[model samples]
Target chain A: MSVEAMLQTIKLLLPALMPSWRFFSVIAPSPRIEITLLKTAKDTPDSWQEFRPRPAHLSIGSMLKRMFYNARWNEALFLTSLAERLSSNPTEHSSQEILKRIKAELVRNSFDSFDSAATPHLQFRLVFVHREGEQLQKHVTFISPVYGSFGDTDS
Target chain B: MSLDYAIRLTEILLALAFIQQSIEHFRAPRDEQRLFIPRFILSILLLFGFQTQWVCLALVILALFILRRFQGPYNGGSDRMGLLVLCCLSLINFMPSSLWREYVFGYLAIQLVLSYFFSGWVKIKNPEWRNGQALRDVFQFSAYPVSEALRTWMNWPRLLVVMSWSVILFELLFPLSLMTPTTLIIGLVIASTFHLANACLFGFNRFFWIWMAAYPSILWLQQRIFIVEQL
Candidate 1:
């Protein structure tokens, strides 16, 4: 099928897949999410400058493709790692501490396997989005800036 | 090439691809592999290309509905493309004598071709893709990174531009290559090389084989439509 047609199909099905959208508003109405990592461009010398998913220029159909690909691994990895870290203290309020811990865990677990030469560091951030409803407020929280990079392993 | 040989060749490639993917899946953490193992096994069986029609059909359905669902979020393009190829294979197998089988295979070929075009079309329109930045970004620190040398390519914007255009042109013109047997062979070779590069550079090994498996269908359609029209 054409990409346009495929997207139309997805648009028709999105409502069914996410039935609770009507109950609350999205934090970012725009599909694109811009995130600034913890490190500056100078600190990272990776061949690939950015690690975020840039769907800003994509059509809805292409964006859907990115979403599918990201959800398959990237998003899942972040959420799983976060959940694991959060398991120890469910009431923790320090997003910064949690982010730091997540970054450390990723370094310990993922960096060596992905040993790329260009990226100097891994960075992450926390994003809290609130949905206001008639009777209650729903807050959805996730890591905003999570990226993987392969740096030159001198070894 | 003859349609018979073309189809057989595709079957071989498909079998190899799925078996490789299954092995990779098996190597992953148990939690990830558990649900996909059975489907991968069945796909490998179907790849043998000698299975009974009913058996192949059953395997395809099971892989699509049951095994694929179990794979959960991990499943994406590879699974979707694999399913497409398997469905086409099943349809072709179940109705070997039907005149409409050619159309079924044609549809598969068209979808594969469009997949390429759509990907390129999307990229060409995006400034990041056009400037070669997207390529750099993907190679740098994404899920599949091969080496540090890939980063140096960013320094040469001209090279990146040329490479980006090459890809876009290749994808857009891929369908035209199906106009003749010779062109179709050439097209398949080029397409195979592209997939091979993706596999070696990005670990998209599954895409390599699954896309290769679709080649025979394209060849079949070309021979069916263009050759007959020439006659």
Candidate 2:
């Protein structure tokens, strides 16, 4: 089997091995994983529910992936910068170009951290929120992930 | 009377829900585009009413992986509930002849009842939800887009308390809906209206449709399967 298939199998089995529950990506004062591992030695498999891993929203792997993703926001502003530019321009051709640029940059930068079997390939969307008086009125959205589709709506 | 009829109806409603949600996702496709391809594929299968069990199972599994990868089962209760429904459907498809089908349906029915119970129980533990302040605070937020009329109702603490308690009581008593077919129909109607109101008020359209899709399973368990098994 391929590595991807192996990883998928691991994810499915993880719940059984660990506890199937909900957990915050970041637990205040200390990480959930740290606490879970510490507690695991003394507790039975069923006792993991106290750690609260919401399988519906989070799994052991995904929570870590999100933490890593968020951690890199400061260092990797390439996508966000492009998104800002695209949102400001809010044009069809520019949106497409920004998307192409992002894909190329992802490859060129050798952003290997996010290339883990666990992490997902990122896409970008540019959203423009227009105002009616002081209140936000509408949204003009340009999506790069859908091959550069544009959507506009009065929110 | 047969499980076949219930399954067919559930499948159709689920298909429509998937299609509707897929369109919304397509509008502002997830940040992880490649990972979401399985979701796109599953939507197609569901929309066409594909009954190919193995293929549907593969697609559902793929979709779950994508959800895991994106850390998006975190999106909200809807994604979680949708995954549950899909998982249950796949299990039924995979083991068509085994008692596994009944077990899975029973599991779903129990989970459905638990969803409401736990939500109500959790809220009742909170002071805000108990006193109606939760609704009042929720409507005051711009994210929810409350109408001026609804927003004004926040000032009436007594009314808010009544509304809140109504929700709390109904949700707490939801499992009792399983007692009889008549109660089940009445409960489902009230629950459907609750979801509808939530959709209208909170823009939780996905929850509205997907929860409705799960109704057939609940109906099957309460009216048909559970009755037979109890005897």
Candidate 3:
């Protein structure tokens, strides 16, 4: 393989060699994940909940602890990057991985086990927070197909 | 700072970043996750400065797997910078020749310098960033604002514009600061404070730590490499 291609593979397999430093290249709408439980394909939905909600109050101790332990917040950033990736390149592997992980997490949160007999499904949409002001405005950007009852397979 | 001291700091600080990441991955309540135990142990080994070269090598491999687990960097530049520190420090440990070790550390310094330059280089070309609208928007609507209350900084337009240009100029001219020990120390402090401010504003604590870990290499190289070139 070419050196660039090899480097890309190694990056995935053994990372930390990235050379680019450009960040926040441009302003664009940011994404948030919202999901609703579905009993059937035709069911509208009972209610939608943000998959992860930022706490209204951030304690000083918790902020300090984030220096060494901010895993959940980092995961939210990871998911946001994946959503941006999905918007730019719909077929990207990272985008699909985001979908897969989100499906699994939602199922795990909703049901006790993977082997549970309940056949509930999950449908998620990307809510794009489009503008900044006294109040943040958001709109649904993309909706994934409804996931399986157990989230065992791709929807 | 001596190369040896710099390498030690790099290893320890990078170990902290690794420890921070490994904890979540190791016990994140997700069943599909793998390699829980060793990842945790190796991070501790790295932290304690056990077998330097071997531990770094093992962690590099695990880090790649961790990257695969996340499908990309788990935390963007912070993860990449953490890995870069890990990879370079391993090479520094394994390379027997003092000259080779110096060159590796110098390479990391050059990368660090170029990172700042390129960050400013790109922003200088962008109209919005130059005019402060981009940064204003960042504070206003970006996902990065740590909390809603912090977003109030966007209301101060003149301060936003001045802060934007200060960042641009500081970053763009940062390389010239390497010419002397005094300027280099000043630049490092500014750069570090900038990272700290970012961590405070955006809650990217890993960026602050990982970039701090990379600084010792630059410090060692500044005395040995960059200043020598200047002389």
- Which number leads on TM-score? 3
* Per-model tally of clashing residue pairs: 9, 10, 1
Each model's chain A TM-score? 0.25, 0.26, 0.71
lDDT of 3 by residue, A82-125 (tens): 87777776654665566666665655665233232453666777
Best by DockQ: 3
**Cα shift from native, residue B210, model 2 (Å):** 0.6
Under CAPRI classification, how is model 3 graded?
acceptable
Please give the lDDT score for candidate 3. Answer: 0.76
For model 3, the stretches where C-alpha displacement exceeds 4 angstroms are: A1-8, A11-18, A45-49, A57-61, A91-119, A129-141, A148-150, A153-155, B30-33, B226-231
lDDT value for model 2: 0.54
lDDT of 1 by residue, A1-155 (tens): 57775565455333222222111011121111112322433353232222233222324443234321332233333343343334434333333333443444445653333333443444443332222332223232433333442332111
In candidate 2, which residue ranges exceed 4 Å CA deviation?
Answer: A1-155, B29-41, B146-150, B229-231
1 versus 2: better DockQ goes to: 1
Would you list the clashing residue pairs of candidate 3?
A: A13-B64
For model 2, how does the per-residue alpha-carbon lDDT over B134-173 read when each residue is reduced to its tens digit? 6665554323322334456567889879988988888889
Considering TM-score, which of the candidate structures 1 and 3 is the better prediction for this target?
Answer: 3
Candidate structures ordered by DockQ, highest first:
3, 1, 2
Deviation (Å) of B147 in candidate 2 = 5.6
Score candidate 2 by DockQ: 0.03
Q: Provide the lDDT at B68 for model 3.
A: 59
